[model samples]
Target: MEPADAVTPVDPVARIEAGPEGPQIGVFFDLDGTLVDGFTATAHAGDRIRRRQARIGEVTGVIEAAMRYRLGRVNFAKLLERAAGYLRGESLADLDAVGERLFQERVQSRMYPVMHEIVLAHQRRGHTVVMSSSALTIHAEPVAKFLEIDHVLCNQFEVDAEGRLTGRIARPVIWGKRKAAAVQEFCGRHGIALQTSYFYADGNEDIALMSLVGHPRPVNPRRELAAMAAARGWPVLRVENPGKGNHGGLRGVLK
Candidate 1:
């Protein structure tokens, strides 16, 4: 099916008109706020680095970028770039270890049960499930492993022959439009139908890819995302944090 040029609303859990055993379809998910409340592993990794090296400027940049990201003013590419730069001379292996530790310490507990259930449902239905994010490989890989997702489309850092980080990001840094492009490429390679695929995300930056999918579900969306979801008639899902109970009102609207 051709990619849609217009935004269309859809039920979050509506099934396609396929039979018990249907054609191949893909279910894409955004990493940060959609599947998990937020991605704190990156922050955790950076903090770990800062504790040893103590670069105030780098730490401050991270804080500023994070704030901008939370405000929806910073896109994933920019955020990933900044985060990668902080580990300029660090070893890739060390960063990978830190990434795993950060995932277990900070990110593992933040996953939403509702989102996990949705992933399982799609898996049982034989859909290809993928985690797409602008987060670097170090931060995204562990989470994908924990979720048992086999495919991932995310940003990566450039490393030297010696396996040291070069403080630069690999090409096509997965962000807004770039992320949409990656999903399209994946569909082309796997013979999946874009018109029948699903994409669930929470960030406003995901609109490009979300619009391309047949079903776009916004989970605990931000202000702009919530407004767009309502305007487009896209389904909105609310999942409480693992420990937090029901939080009502506008604040709850944007998790």
Candidate 2:
């Protein structure tokens, strides 16, 4: 496959505006490294560390799991579970509140302007925009609310009776192909045609959903995804500025 030279970032909103728009058109966007610049989970993890919530052993475990997953040794679920373990016993409410504050302070300005324009174009056309990532509700919901995206398909934490994190992800980790399936199911439920929908992402894990959508828009794609996009002639959108580079994606840091 050729390199993504032919797929450099271009303003694609004009082409999008030419397409049919309605609630039946589902437009999916990956959270980190696609819609936003840096990883939101990075901020979340930093907050945990700043407050002395993350233990040394847990942080080491998360980094190790992330490395293993990157090397294709451990599964994404393992990486996510390992990271999620650090949040045990934390109040979900507190986490949510901090997530909002962190977004305003750390994540909001990092959003890529190009992606924001694309999202608004989709909204103007009345498309059903969704936030789809393995990032937790804390990391994803704020962005969804800010962007006015009504639907979200992402991993979530399970809590005990008192609304404390159980250190376990709720069933069905929404990563890779599972994330793809979640989108498909949502489209089915809403009568949105997948063949006409669009998916924008930066990670190789997003390839599953990318393959299924009519438009596989790769935003700042990592090498593997770049290669795949080039081979398939998918339109790749790159942000050349510093800090906009794909930082191993939300999967690399999210709990």
Candidate 3:
């Protein structure tokens, strides 16, 4: 007689909600430096920066300015416009393809397993998972798909009919308050309550989003964010070098 089928197919969404009795939680994660160790897309963009093939530093400077603006020190619109200007005149297909290739080859491999497990654990607990990044949507979307994230909040580029890049953002750039805006819109559309959500990020630029969530945690945070998180009494997680047995709170679940 044939043996009874014993394998069970687990539902990721259901698994993500298996935590202690409470309202369903939504986990929003920042892509660079939070989920992953570094900025892969930015590093790839650096190639164009170094070659002067593009005004990458100018764009980056604007990004930095935008971060500062989020901290209430500058004009956000001006910084965004300046950043968009740097990408003018590029072929969208070429830039996107190059970025995708570089990201898959050099960046994807460096993903920390502990971080991956944390994402999965949240998923298994039935939490709605989102990947929010300052990178262009072309890059962030693929990474989101690869990680099976439920949603993505990222920047979009305008492309002409000929597939050439107009170097203008198709929508408001997703960073800082823009990120918080995107999250708010998403929650509104999905009927999700922001008061019960969670957000994880590592940089000073993400403070707006961190403040928006009910449960905010800083994971592998930068020095500035670390200080802020401590002052706010938020949890700080360190997952680097999991093999050496330093996974922090993730150890129990991982084992």
On lDDT, the candidate that comes out on top is: 2
Task: Give the range of the ten consecutive residues with the poorest summed lDDT in model 3.
Answer: 1-10
- The candidates, ranked best first by lDDT, are 2, 1, 3
Looking at model 1, which ten-residue stretch has the lowest summed lDDT? Answer: 246-255
| Per-residue alpha-carbon lDDT of candidate 2 for residues 179-217, written as tens digits (9 for 90 to 100) | 999998999899999888889899988988899988778
Q: Which has the higher TM-score value, candidate number 1 or candidate number 3?
A: 1
Model 2 TM-score (2 dp): 0.89
Question: Stretches of candidate 3 above 4 Å error?
Answer: 1-24, 49-86, 241-255
* Clashing residue pairs found in predicted model 2: none
Ten residues in sequence with the least summed lDDT for candidate 2: 246-255
User: What C-alpha lDDT, on a 0 to 100 scale, does residue 37 get in candidate 1?
Assistant: 78
lDDT of 2 at 201: 94
Clashing pairs in model 1, backbone N/Cα/C closer than 3 A? 9-233
lDDT of each: 0.75, 0.82, 0.68
**Stretches of candidate 2 exceeding 4 Å from the true structure:** 1-10, 242-255
Per-residue lDDT, model 1, residue 226, is 78
